[model samples]
Target: MSDRWRTLRRRIITPDVSETRLDVRGFHVKNQVARDILETVGKSFLAGYAIAAEAKDQSIAERRIDALQPRFRGFAYEGAAMAYAVIDGLSLWRRDNSPRFLAGPGDRHIYMAYVGIGWAMARVPRFRWQRLVLPDPTLRWLALDGYGFHQAYFKTARYVYDQYRDPSFTWHGGGPQSYVQRAIDQGIGRAMWFVYGTDAVRVADAIDGFDPERHQDLYSGAGLAATYAGGADEAELQTFWQRAGEHRPFVAQASAFAAEARIRAGLLVPHTEVATRVFCGMTATAAATLAETTRPDGPDGDQLPAYEIWRQQVAREFVAIGRN
Candidate 1:
């Protein structure tokens, strides 16, 4: 195994006994604070993986998650990401027979995972940009923000340079000209979204300084972030959906994806399905079927690949369906 992987394995499997130095390749991660956060993430992963692995059923797993809180205490956002890694690991180890508690949106942990990913990215040390491939599920997700951070940092830097170079200078605006640019912007917005606790109003409040006309990509980025993190209720989602204005369809599509994630997470019980249905037009049945089919025993037999395919299709559907 790669040294990084071995290090993580040792840390997660036997944390108390393992006091080895953290060595992520290409990353100058010497900061104690950053290392502690990373270690917390690892511990969080182990907690989820072990619980899911041992549970008799979904109910048991759900009940077991409560005990993991103290282990992940103090760092809510990072802990959530770590928990997700555990779920992902559980999904991988069990393959076809993944537990239901770790399954869908009906479970509360799914939303926590998305939030955790956002928090991790926001706190990523600039030095670790090159080693975005650190051997951890949560870090892999966090690495996605590098694209956005590159654009945000440079664009803002240029903006700062211009303002300082010439007091009378006006801001020059640009839109994303390529997929990478769009991804970068989206990543940035997602990070901000997490930092703001996925609250649409809070995110809106935070990005109010951004000009929608000039920073179109960031606007879209914020929309995607809010939609996915879904820190708000259905009524709030509707309000935020309308708040997106020009980016409404994109935001709606993101909400649809969140709904899909929730469904896959197994949160689509009969009484609770309406909330997501209203939020994204994705019904419980569709979500549940997709969740089932993506499982190892399901027709497709692989959750990760199946989920991406479903997300794309659902996104297209939401866009075509329009915000109405």
Candidate 2:
């Protein structure tokens, strides 16, 4: 296809930017801060997607994304990762670009990049799913997390209100599919933070409304969202922690994860710092270090996926800290 045709094809396939608007999506707006946070995320994501769709090379896209402010840069990377994954999945002609990007410029934004792949998975048909690049065995689960976030954010009523779970979800027909649902629920839990307008109590209440078996993962997702996106103040974070109750360890684990993501990208913002303090009772660096220290040596071990083991270990650290 001609370059113009490719551009047109992408345009036809990509969702409209207007779909991200609060009014268009019918998402709640707790206040200006909440509105700004969600809108910025949408805008950055689209911006990255556009760059990836149009740029002649990965370096060009990386340079453009680098121009974005630190606070939103990772979100743009997420969008770029999504676009590349979509390109790879839909166009057999394209090289395996997503993996290259992930191995290079997208490395710092690895978490967001995996989530981006999940977004691409959501857009592409199931038959083409195998074509998309998901390099990390452990972190690859974040793609499902992204998939969950995309569904909950876009189809809130069915996902959030009705508490839906896809019984047919399978990870390329490997492993127990129930684990896939758990990863997705984590993403849904993350989206709840944004859907409720970053109101800590509302986010907590939404998690509470879910099945008890799902609460720990939900709290993990919400905690990651709250700490990473940071729409709440210290007092609000304290409220969220208090409400988490039995799930406090999970939430703290999320804080550690969020801290590591931000710190790894050199995009640690003040809001993240405040959130880490409230959620983990430590600096963001310390929380990130804790996450690293607790991570399993490999991606799979001891019969359980290494990813879950890593998260469980982090949560145990929090429990050991007397927060249990």
Candidate 3:
């Protein structure tokens, strides 16, 4: 095994008994902080998505724009770009005694940037259908294409750069990109397995050499083996899989971009296709189902809301992809 992986394995499998609880506590605190940051960002993203979706409705008359246009006009593109920049900057900040609860200033900046982008997109007078094209569909594809790439770039760059910022850090388990990709892939499999007869105990045991019970504190509520012990009914699993298939196009595109970025960064084998078809299929199914159920009026209903639909869709896909 690579030294980095060895180190991580040792840390998990044979932790120093005296320091075990302390380490667990540290991890929990950091994780909670991270979760909070993600939640805030997610909410902001959902709001932006909803506004944009409303603007995209074909049925809405031009006069209606007077009321809704101002809702997102100020931030649209600028807000999103700023959010990306902020995230990039925050990830690079270094300070001693920084509270784990708050992300670095860069985090706040990134949030602002995203807000700006959303506002701009939401406020555009004509709904700019050209901006929605993807995968080289049109001359405007470049702008749309950059959106995901920018997000991934900021996330991966921040993570990798953070590790490197610490002189003692070593890159391991393939590399950050590969590691993340594998986790995403395996997470999907594990989640599916969990739906079958796998339990938290089994998952914990499956690791190189860790005591399941001792590590129980590391898990979120869903991580509890007891939660999955009952196993999902076959019919439910089948239904989920069916829905996942519909989202294949979007998932495939995202995975392809991620894989390409990893390869270009030399973080993984140049030829590796880190994107998994199976996982994409599963996640797509879940996303489509969530979109349908959560926004029955399509992306136009005020009652259900557009951004909420997008958020639910993303959440379902994330769940279908499993925990990473």
TM per candidate comes to 0.43, 0.95, 0.19
Candidate 3 ranges beyond 4 A from true positions: 1-243, 269-274, 277-324
Q: Arrange candidates by lDDT, descending.
A: 2, 1, 3
Better of 1 and 2 by TM-score: 2
Reference-based lDDT, each prediction: 0.41, 0.87, 0.27
Scored against the true structure, residue 128 in model 2 reaches a CA lDDT of: 90
RMSD, one per candidate, in order: 12.7, 1.6, 21.6
Residue 121 CA displacement from its true place in model 3, Å: 15
Task: List the candidate numbers ranked by TM-score, top first.
Answer: 2, 1, 3
lDDT of 2: 0.87
Q: Kindly list the per-residue Cα lDDT of model 1 for residues 1-324, writing each as its tens digit.
A: 365653464355322313212342112243455445434534554454444334444455455555544324212323434333333333324422222322442134444443343333334443322222223232223233433432332343332122112233221111112232333445566544444444556555545555544234444455544443333456765665555566554554444444454454443333234434654466655534543343332222133323233434544555666644
Error of 1 at 81 (Å): 7.0
For residues 163-202, what per-residue lDDT tens digits would candidate 3 score against the true structure? 1122332222121222222222222222222222223233
TM-score for model 3? 0.19
The positional error of residue 180 in candidate 2, measured at the CA in angstroms, is 0.9
